[model samples]
Target chain A: MAQFMDVHHGMKGITADQLREAHQADLAIEKDEGVHFEKAWADPESGTVYCLSEAPSAEAVQRIHERAGHRADEVVPVPLTV
Target chain B: MAQFMDVHHGMKGITADQLREAHQADLAIEKDEGVHFEKAWADPESGTVYCLSEAPSAEAVQRIHERAGHRADEVVPVPLTV
Candidate 1:
C-alpha cells in the first residue's frame, strides 16, 4: 500500500472536536476503498489540515475525504518517505 | 515543542538521489535551530514535498529549510494531532 499525505484548506475556525469528528467520518468508510487513515494533523489557526493515510492511490484518499464532506484541496502521492 | 507540517512546491523532476541529499542537508543543520525533522515525503511529479518535524515554532522549521537551501512554501503549526 502507498502512503499519502493530503492537505485540506478552507476549513477555517475548525475546532479540535470538529477535527476529530471529521477524521472519524473518513475512518468509517475508509475500508470500503481499501484506505487506512493513519494520522491527521490540524492547524486551526490557518484552517489547514493534513492527513496521512495508506491507500491504493491518491484518488482513493480524495474520495474518502470528499465523502466525509471536506474535500481536500490537494492530494499528493508520497512515494518517498524518510 | 510543537509538531509542524511544511510543504515545498516547485521542485519538479526531483529524483530519489536529490531528495535524499536535500533531506541530509536539513538534518545536518537542523540542530542549530533546535529542530528535528522527523520525516519527509515527496512527489517528484507534482514538485511538492511535505516535511514533518518537531520544533519550537514554524519559524524554526522554515529557518532550517531556508538555510538548507529549499525554503518551504507553507508551514502550519500542528497543534492537534491524532
Candidate 2:
C-alpha cells in the first residue's frame, strides 16, 4: 500500500478533546478499509489536523474520512524511500 | 517527480513573519535540487509548517530543508491518482 498524508483544515473552533474524540471515532473504521492510520496531529488554534496513513489510494483515505463525517481538505500521496 | 508532504513541528516560539522568512529561504534552494514547492501553510501558534511539493525522493526534500537549516520532522510520499 502507498502512504498518504490527509490534511484537514477549518477546525478552529474545535477543542482538543473534541478533536481526539473525532479522531478515535474515525480510526475505528480503518480496519475495514485496509488503511493503516500511523499517526495524527491536531493544531488546537488553527483547528487543522494532519493524519499519516498507509493506504491503497488517496480516494480510499478520503472515503474513510467521509465515512467518519469529516472531509479531508487535501490528500497528498507519500512516496517511500525504500 | 513524486509528490511529498513534509510536516514540520516544534515552532511554538516562532512568529508568523519569522516562519515565512524561513520558508522563503528554503524554497529558494528547491529549484536547484529539482524540487517543486507547490504550496505551504504555517501555524503561528504552534510553529508548525506543512509544505506540499513534488520531488524525486524523500532525501531530496530533506536535503532542501537541511540546506535551509531546518529539519523535517516527517517526509511522507504522496501517490498521484493520475
Candidate 3:
C-alpha cells in the first residue's frame, strides 16, 4: 500500500472537531474502496484540511474523498518517511 | 491556538513506524515549548515527512522540530479548515 497526503483548501474557520467528524464519515465508507484513512489535520483559520491515507493509488484516495463529500485539491503520493 | 503544517524533506526510505517513534520522542519534550505535536505522516518513496501541530507561532513549531532533530524544510501556518 502506498501512502498519500491529500490537501483540501478554503476550509478556514472550521474546527478540528468538525474535521474529525468528516474524516470519520469518510472512513466509514473507505473500506469498500480498499483505502485506509489514517489521520487528519485542519487549520480552521487557513481553511486547509489534510488527510493521510494508504491506498493502491491517488485516484482511490480522491474517489473516496469525493464520495465522502470533501474533494481534495491535491493528492500527492508520499514515498518516503522518517 | 494556531495550527501549522511543517514539512521535512529527504526522509525517503524510512518507515511509518519509525516516523511515529520520532514523533513520540518529540512529544515527550514538546511541552516545554508549549507546542503540541498532534500527528505526523511520511512518504518513504518521496522522502517527505509532514507534521501537524498547534502552537503560538510558526517559529515555535520550527523550534520544536529543530529540537527533535528533524528540522522542517517549510513551516506554514494553516489559517483555515473545513
Candidate 4:
C-alpha cells in the first residue's frame, strides 16, 4: 500500500471534537475501500483538515473521504520520507 | 497565491523542537521564493511532517522546503474548504 496525505479546506470554524467525530466515522467504513486512515489533524482556525492513510490509490482515499462526508480537496501519493 | 499542503516523511523520532527550528529557518528565507509557510505539524512516531503554505505554486513550496534542508515528499494544491 502506498501512503497518501490528503487535504481538505473550507472548514474555518470546525472544532477539534467535530473533526474527531468525522474521522472516527470515516475509519469505521474505510476498510471497505481498501484504505486505512492512520491519523487526522485539523486546524480549526484555518478550516483545513489533513489525513494520512495507507491505500492502494489516491482515489480510494478520496472515496473514503467522500463517503465520510468531508471530501478532500487534494489527494496525492507521498513518494519520500525524512 | 494558492494554498498548498506539503508532506514529509522518514523522520521518525524527531522532536517537536527540531521541527519548529527547521520551520522557522525555512520561513526566514521563504520570501525569496514567493512562499509563505503558515503552520506545520509533526508526528514523531510516524516521522511525518505536514506544512501549510500560501504560494504561487507547489514548486515554490518544494523549493522552500528544499532550501530548509527538509525536502517535502509531496506537495499538492488544496482547492476546497468546509
Best by lDDT: 1
The models' CA-based lDDT, in order, is: 0.91, 0.74, 0.81, 0.79
Q: Name every residue pair that clashes in candidate 4.
A: A9-B81, A9-B82, A10-B81, A10-B82, A11-A47, A11-B82, A81-B9, A82-B9, A82-B10
Interface RMSD of each: 1.1, 14.3, 5.0, 9.2
Predicted candidate 2 versus true structure: per-residue lDDT over B16-54, tens digit per residue: 566667778877898888988776655444456777778
Q: What is the TM-score of each predicted model, taking all chains together? A: 0.95, 0.52, 0.65, 0.55
Model 1 residue B67 CA deviation in Å: 1.3
Alpha-carbon runs more than 4 Å astray in model 2: B1-82
User: How much is the lDDT of residue B1 in candidate 4?
Assistant: 92
Worst 10 residues of 4 chain A by lDDT: A73-82
Q: Which stretches of model 3 miss by more than 4 angstroms?
A: B1-3, B8-48, B53-56, B63-82
Error of 4 at B53 (Å): 0.4
Candidate that beats the other on TM-score, 1 or 4, i.e. the better one: 1
Q: Candidate 3's residue-wise lDDT over B1-75, tens digit each?
A: 888888888987878678877897789888888999877777677677788788989988888788888889978
Tens digits of per-residue lDDT, candidate 4, B1-82, equal 9777787889887776788788888889999989999877666666777787899988889988888899999786654322
In angstroms, the error of model 3 at A68 is: 1.2
lDDT of 1 by residue, B1-82 (tens): 9999999899898888888999999999999999999988888888989989999999999999999999999888889887
Candidate 3 chain B worst ten-residue window by lDDT: B73-82
What C-alpha lDDT, on a 0 to 100 scale, does residue B14 get in candidate 2? 62
Clashing pairs in 2: A11-A47, A77-B77, A77-B78, A77-B79, A78-B77, A78-B78, A79-B77, A79-B78
Q: Give the DockQ (C-alpha) for candidate 3.
A: 0.31
